[model samples]
Target: MRVVLTTWGSRGDVEPLAGLAVALRGLGAETVVCAPGDDDFVELLARAGVAHMPLGPTVRSVVAGPKPPGAAAAFKLAPELVAARFETLARAAEDGCDAILATGLMPAGARDVADKLGVRYVLACFHLLGLPSQFSAPGRRPGTPSPEGETDNRKLWQQDAERVNALYGPALNEHRAAIGLPPVDNVRDYVFTGSPWLAADPVLLPSEGMTDLDVVQTGAWILPDDRPLPDGLEAFLDAGAPPVYVGFGSMAAYAPKDIAGVAIEAARKHGRRVVLASGWAGLSAIDDGGDCFVVGEVNQQALFRRVAAVVHHGGAGTTTTSARAGVAQVVVPQIADQPSWAARTAELGIGVAHEGSTPTVDSLSAALATALDPQMRARAEAVATTIRPDGAAVAARMLLDGASAAA
Candidate 1:
């Protein structure tokens, strides 16, 4: 069997699919990963030994250089951008593919491609955003209370649905019409097709009233192993007590230096050592010395284990990494589903979610203090105990089972 797995966005998006591809290959399925044509991403696929199919714009171009303030402004071009991405998936799926598994960021036309090719399609979500729940909104900010009434929750869900349709409906319908499919009225419903695979642990996000959707909680699909830490980072970790990790992943591209400085200052105020992840945000430019190490991208799993606490943008991948490593977290969410993950981290009692989009020194210091508390550390360790280590294997088996059943 040949499986084509597609995803978009930063390392968070690409890493999970790469892990799944490796697992599927082990299960006797020839796997291909279709993602942006970025050199780093292509190199990642090459290193993972998974077949690669380049598609869409490079993530750096999309995320690195930008002139947007809020998440809403950043996504102004979503319709056209998503349409172009779907066209790429459509073209890629035209090949002899047996199944199409896509991440949450994949365009709605991914399902259309599977239908057009007569193959099994599975939608995999790293977070709980895609699954509709009356208990709470999908991507609400951390610490925001769930609506008391189910009616209010449904209304919030409907508004999100409308917002998605408004952003991608025209282009989506155009592609559908071009491909001889009926127009979709609800983009959310269209995107959440087939047996929905949730790439998170059920213990972390229990499915209580999500019976309307065929949701499968497959745990967290972590990368196979850690890349070697830089010599400087190793030396820093060896020099003193575990340092706090501070990085915003792809969220703080515009002001990485400023963000890094703020984080370093906050940690210094609390007399804590810090490791700053440059990631796509370009934090490597900051040249802070003495107890503060500004380094380029390294494996989250490895670094989180060496760190006493993690202060980050609350990406789903980073959240899971911190949890599984038994480190406390301080989430400073900026955009998209980050706020939701931040909320979840706080709700799990493993972290503190700093309020506001940008973190002030005071707020960050306070959150960092909370994350380093003994009780929070214990809770984080307890949460780590419940996470399945073989999420990739379980996801591969689930996909195979779904394909067999469809056949």
Candidate 2:
């Protein structure tokens, strides 16, 4: 079977899909990763030996570029961006492909393209974003009870659906009309069609009340394996005790240097060694001194295994990696699905979630103190034992099975 797996966003988004592509190829399925034309992602597809086709703007460009002032402003602008990018997605999916499996970031036009092509369309995601749930909502404060009741939750979901329609409906309808496809009133329903695959561990995040959506809780789809670490990093690890890993994945947009300095100071205050990743924000630009090693991008799986604990921006992929590594986590969420994952982390007793979106030295120090606690370490290790190791393989089988059934 020939499958086109489409995804966009940062390494956190692309890595999981790349892992899936590798797994699909291993199972004798011909897979192509339809993503942004970024060098890193293109090289990743090449190394994995999966076919690649360019689709959207590179995540690096977006992360490195200027962002809107507030979350509301960013949210308001998201639909226009999605609409603008739909043509590329349509072109990628309209080709001769057996099926199209798209991440949540893929515009709703992907579903229309798959329908026009008369092929299967599947929605896959790492976070619980598109799936409707009364018990939880994306960006909700962690550990807070559902005060508004199911009616209120449903209303909120409907409001979200309406917002999506209001934002993207015009441009989406224009594209639909051009393609001779009928316009959709509910964008969420159109985008989240088919048996959606949730690439998160059921052990870590169960699917108790999510029966309403045709969602599959495939365990966290981690990258296949680790790449070799740099010689300097290897020496740094050997020179001292396991240092705490501090890096904010792709969310270094605002003030990376200040954040890095804070992390370094906090680690110093605790008398702990630290390995700080530069990530997209260029955190490694900060000078390295005693007990601190600043480096460029490295294999997260390998680094997490050797770290005493992880302090990060709480992306879904990072959270899962820390959990699988059996290391305590100190989540300092910046935006989006981060707060939700942070809440889940604290609720599971695997780590501590800082109270706010932004982190200060004091807050990070406190969270790190909790993370380094003996009890927290033990709980994290226990959680690690429950994460399924064959998540990518399982997801691969599911996609292949769906294709075969459709055939």
Candidate 3:
């Protein structure tokens, strides 16, 4: 079966789907991945041995860098509102395939292709795009959804629904008519994300309104095997025992120097070494006046395991990676989903938040102490082991099974 996976956004967004594509390839399914134009993602797909097609420029411009005040906000709502129009959609669909799976905001075009081909479509819900409870890690009992999960945050979801309608509804009908296929009952029906026949768990997912019968918790979908650690990382791990692992993933957009002094001071206070990642956002230079080494883009899963504790601006992927490594986390959220994941880490008792709104040497040192505590570290290790066996191959098989049914 031919399977096409479409996604847009930063490395965190595109990389998961790429992992899925690699898994699908293992099943002998023909797989193609589509994402906005970016050399990093392009190279990543190639390295993973997955076929890729570039859609457009990487849209990080909206989130970071100097731009129009609300440009990011507008694009966040309806990405199609700012991206290549229906022609791109048409072109993507032109490649015959059994099914099309796409992430949020970029689904309109893929949905058009799915309708044109009369094939099944699935939406990958990496985060709570419209779901409120899915917005934050709930404080409820395990496996229970939060009360506010359903309560619309001032009709934000309805706006998302409306935005979906405004962006995709017209093109959907036109595409259906062009192919002589009946229009779907409602645009939402084709939109399946959670469970029994047509659903699955959300990431940092709330448990409310879901039953054991509704969704399968396959744990977090991650790279099947841990990548090799860099040359200097092992030495860092051995330095003064496991020091706290501090690095924001791809979304960090601050001047590294501004953050460097604080991190070094904190590391000294805790009497631990520091391993900083200079990811796409350039965070390593924050090492001014410190002995910290800015390790540029190393294997996080492997590195996290070798660390005594972690401090980060919680992206979902980073959060899960740290959790799976069983090391306590000290979250200094930057923006978007960072705060929500930070709240979850604190709630789970595996970590603590920075004392102040912004992380500083004092607060970061305190959080590190809490994270490195024996009890917290043990708890984190247990959670990590529980979720570590997440089956990328199984998920790939599931996608292929869906495609085979479609065929």
In the range 1-407, model 2's lDDT, one tens digit per residue, is 88888877777788888889888888988887777777877877777777777765566665676652444544544554565446655565554678888884636667777777788888888877557777655333222234455456677667667766765677777877887889889876788874677888887677656635878878877666658989989998999888988888777565334788888878877888999887777776346476888877577788888888998888888999899999999888777778778889999999888898667788789888999988999999999998898889999898889888987
lDDT of 1 by residue, 255-351 (tens): 4337787888788888888888777666753454788887775767788888989998888888888888999999888777787788888998999
Q: Rank the candidates by lDDT, best first.
A: 1, 2, 3
TM-score of each: 0.88, 0.90, 0.80
lDDT at position 87, candidate 3: 45
Task: Compose the digit string of candidate 3's lDDT tens values, residues 188-277.
Answer: 435544452211223344544532224433344575545687667676566557776777666545423345557767877978777777
Clashes of 3: 11
Using TM-score as the measure, which candidate wins? 2
- Order the candidates by TM-score, highest first: 2, 1, 3
* Cα RMSD (angstroms) for every candidate in the order listed: 4.0, 3.8, 5.7
Model 1 has a clash total of 1
